[model samples]
Target: MVKCFETGAYVLNGREIVKDDAEAQAKLASMLGQSADKEAAKQGTMAYGVIQAHNHAEQGGLLKLKFDSLTAHDITYVGIIQTARASGMEKFPMPFVMTNCHNSLCAVGGTINEDDHKFALSAAQKYGGIYVPTNLAVIHSYNREMMAKPGNMILGSDSHTRYGALGTMAIGEGGGELAKQLLGKTYDLAKPEVIAVYLTGKPQPGVGPQDVALQIIGNVYNNGYVKNKVMEFIGDGIQNLSVDYRNGIDVMTTETTCLSSIWETDDQVKEYFLIHGREGDYKTLKPEAVAYYDGLVYVDLSAIKPTIAMPFHPSNIYTIEEFKANAAEIINYIEVEGRKQFDVPNLDINLRSKLRNGAFMVDQGIIAGCSGGTFENLTDAADIMRGGSTGNGTFTMSVYPGSQPINIELVRNGAMETFMSAGVIVREAFCGPCFGAGDTPANQEFSIRHATRNFPNREGSKPTDGQISYVALMDARSIAATAINGGKLTAATEIDVNFTRPKYTFNKSIYDFRVFNGIGKETPETELLMGPNIKDWPAMPNLTEDILLKVITYITDPVTTTDELIPSGETSSYRSNPIRLAEFTLGRKDPQFVPNAKVLQKLEVAREHGENPVELDASLAAIYDKIKSIDPEKVVDPKEIGIGSAVFANMPGDGSAREQAASCQKVLGTWANFAKQYATKRYRSNLINWGMLPFEVSGDPVFDKDDYVYIPNIRSAVLSGQPEIPAYVIGDEVKAFTVKLGSLSKEEREVIAAGCLINYYKVK
Candidate 1:
């Protein structure tokens, strides 16, 4: 279904693919009537043009990007704004939209979510920004409707912030990046390589965007084929799919771990802007005549089938046919994978027990969030359930529109009525289901969702509490099909239903009436609405000369996600409060992590003051003695060492762009993260922004849990451009090992030395 080119390929006129080999120059010259220039061809990609338009850096390779717009959700905006305020920002430098979608429910923490909404509104008025109230729209939906413009770059604090389908290059990052933009600082990065996603053929009838997306994710995710690169979509198939279909596929590009994405826009995209009453934002965007890509993912749309990402990961995919054929084995494998995520004894996943009568039975179905709640997906889902009924059994189904406008359209077109008649509960435009806030299933129940992720504990089940549920990701169509089958795990192709692909009529009145558009109109006198739960960031310490790091927790998971690092769901209410949120760091992965890290933090606190750390923590004296034993000639003093905690994971920071993943570690006195490799650039950036050492140790981590690592003159190594630093693990005797800090920009180096982005800005 998907073919990845082993070597670089060139796209001729956005349609034909010419493999780069011995005869590549000859083939290119024959087509172009001249000698082929690979360097010039590289600039012909749509991504290159977008970057050129937004890039402010004079230097080649390094990019200093200034985005046309910025966006953030409730859980992230407060922290971003607080950081910006502390950084001497008076007003927003660009158009910033703060949407309350993630914590919209306000169900977990009493009045905590609503207080943030009020704070966002006041901040919008005070700082000259835009604010969308709770349940109005998800972060991406609001941006896609009003802010997306052809050839423009948008930076968001949410991971799924891709608007490439509309010819806009959108990147999701941590809150620090957004804060930097607010302070008129450029987003620095290395120029990313562009990979051609050459699409051909029309999708089969029963296929949906999630099916295609899952197929692509499965092929590219594990191999890192498109990691930290741009996936430039091109080809004749662009005319076949609707704009919503393209958007559904584009937003999921975040799952491929690519930096950003862009599409070859056509009349369909133009019509999309026209329908949304933003025709002025429309522009013709296509790759140049000859565009070279680092690699190519050639997709035959017709070959794609209804696919599902099994429990625990978006990359763990299987076609419905293949899964049904080997139901027992596949279910058993998922249970086994679930068991591996946590060490809780008596953790009974029991997915195999749910498989009865040769069919896998599910407990719930959810069609919600940015990827699934688009007008086209919802309409098609409603069409599938028009005459069918979701029987009253152990199964239930719910649908959430992406935005208020989409909800209104669904209500006006009788789609909502159809869903209601089919016994499906329709919800507001909330991102709760996607991140485990709403629609939480009962213990051990299985849910099939069309949301973004299905990570472990993402279904709101605390495995540590002996409450474990499962979520498998499928397309909205198949979820509807499964609903009709009473959650029998039926694919859309197995059911005969005519998909009424309705034309979406955009309604801007909903946002016009509810959203606060304070852009370019600053009211500096407006007071911010603060809640008891909202607190400013705590003081962070600067990098010291010699450092001592205690490995508090060690995770052997192949990939540890941000969700596992800090968690999402209920803890989101505490995002604005750094101290409270840090308490939950690694709460599920390691319950002892907080207490253990705090012990080291106390020692660090004592050392920071006049008090001696060895006196406070008697065991630390032995650690300092071992550190001095490493270099008998060189005297090592415990008073001069900076004491802190660290965590060791094989490959950490996979899923979300939540800064809390790194910020929580910073809050808990974490000074370093030892990983074989980082899963995504955003995670590494978060670590650097929070002033943590993103150390990559090849092969086995020489240190174990609770072991101490001492690095002398660490501050000099960071500021003097030292990529590889010498360190010794403290055991019976100090053992030598080397850890490499990957390439850091001058500004990034300064940020680390200053302790964090906030502290770096403080001096400026």
Candidate 2:
């Protein structure tokens, strides 16, 4: 259904794909000339203008920009403000906002949820930050309505911080990155590669922005097409899509593993800002005539169809049409893969069992989160469910509007009434379900959702506990169709319904009354509240002369995701408690990983205390004897070695922007990670933050489990700043291999040597 061209091609006008080498070059040259002609024809829309604005600023480049305005949701604000306070922040230099969306449910942590909300309110008053009380709006939705601006940069602690549809450049990073911004530290990085996401043609009917996004994600995610690159959306397609349509697609660029994104702006976007009462923020953006793109991704909107990603990955894509045609084969493949992931011998993998009569079936359908919770998506879903009941046989549906404004619109337009009449539950904005804390399914149940991911256990089932379930990603339209068919996986293409496009009337009054506006205010009287669950980072030591690592959990999969590293759902409550949360590291992937890692950690502690490594752990003595037999001169004293553990994965660090993946490993005394490659830049950053050495190993090494990999002068090697280092893996035989450290910033180097970013900051 999808065709990938080796040679770069351009869509001319929107219908023809220029693939011939000479024709492609000619088309590109013509397009460049047209751009120059347009620049001369218009007053704005030149890339040079945007660059000049930044150049005129005191500090150039995407600034370690301290926002004069700031906002965060409940799950992050408490920790963000607490970290700021610990780092000597007295008053808000920006308008910091705390919204209670993530923890709004208050189901997982008892009174702690309400306590966080109350603390946010008090902190707003005392520290001069904005506080939006509980259930006000989802974090991204509120920012879209009030905070985003053209040419301005916004950094959120949440991973879905995208505002490109509003002509704003926003980045979703770890809370520590946000804390650094609050404390006036520049978000340091070498300049990122810019990838042009050239769009053209109008999408076919029934194909929503989510469909287009999934298409692009399926094409780019596996091959790292745009990983760590800035995706600049440009082309004729910009005019074909509405503001909300573009927003839906823009938000999912995070799933493509790109670092940040921006779009070419037009009047529609300008009108959006003006309607929201921020016309002054509107500035059109376009690439220069001769602007260089490190790489290019060409997307034809018309070619995109209603798509679905099967369980376990967002990249496992197939069109709904193809899925219906090859149902049996697909079901069998899912079953086989499910057993591997679940590690169960006789687990039921046949979801086709739910296919009643001649229709494929599902247990639940969800339309929520930044991708699916838009007003148009929810309204259409409600329309499809107007007089239809999902039936009691296994099918259920729930709808969550992106924000309160959307909910109000739904109520005003009768969408809410339609949904309620159909027995569909309408929920307030909460991200728990998207991250696996809510709406858990029974074993072997299949769920179709419009949320962000479908990773194993991301839907909240404990596969290792024998409670296995799966999720499939689809657009809201298809999900509604499936629900209407009583859990059958029906494609929306088969449905005949008129979609009413409603003009969105944004209501700012809700935010005006409930949201605390702390812009241009500074207060120093804030006495920050410290929750018992919140604690400072533990002390970490510097790199030693020699390093020793045990293979705590060796995964041979092609890739290992952050979900596997520190999982979501109930485990999210322990994010602030590093030590307590560390117990779950690799818990699902390897049930014995925690104990195995802890045992290796004890040996490090023993060596630090000037004790013999052999005496500290009996297992080390056996490996030590084998190493000694190879080379007596290579024998190192216990004091000279720093014992830790490592895990081998084909590719690691995929999905989620959570830093706990690497932090949890650091807490468990993991010093290095051996992988063929890393999946995303954010996950790699997580590793750097935790001070773990992210090592790349090529081909198949002769090293086995319990083998000792010795690196001589490890501290000096890092201090000397070599890009690659040679090491010896000693087991039944000693084998030599090369490990690459990749590119590291000076600060990143120091952080690694000092053990972690937290230690670097504490010591600095």
lDDT of 1 by residue, 269-359 (tens): 8998998999998999999888899999999999999999998889999999999999888888877777877778998878887888888
lDDT scores in order: 0.91, 0.75
Candidate 2 structure quality by residue, lDDT tens digits, 1-764: 23344553343332234453556556655765642222232222232333234332354333223443555676567656665666666677666667777777777666666777777777887777777777778788888888887776677767778887776777777666666667766566555666667788898767888888888889988888788777777778789998888989999888888878888888999899888888887887665434445556788888888999998888888898888788788878888776766665555566778656666778999888778898888877876776788887767788878888888998999998988888788888777678887787888888998988898889998877767888999999889888888787877767887788777788889888878776556555656565666666666667787787776677877778788988788877666566887888987788888898888888888777788878866767666665555457875576677889888887887777677788788888889988888887667777776788888778875467667787666777776778778788867666777888777766777778888765667678
- Every model's TM-score: 0.99, 0.91
Stretches > 4 Å off in candidate 1? none
Residue 611 of model 1 has an lDDT of 77
Distance from true position, residue 503, model 2, in Å? 2.3
Error of 2 at 713 (Å): 1.7
Clashing pairs in 2: 70-95, 70-97, 71-97
| Clashes (N, CA, C under 3 Å) per candidate | 0, 3
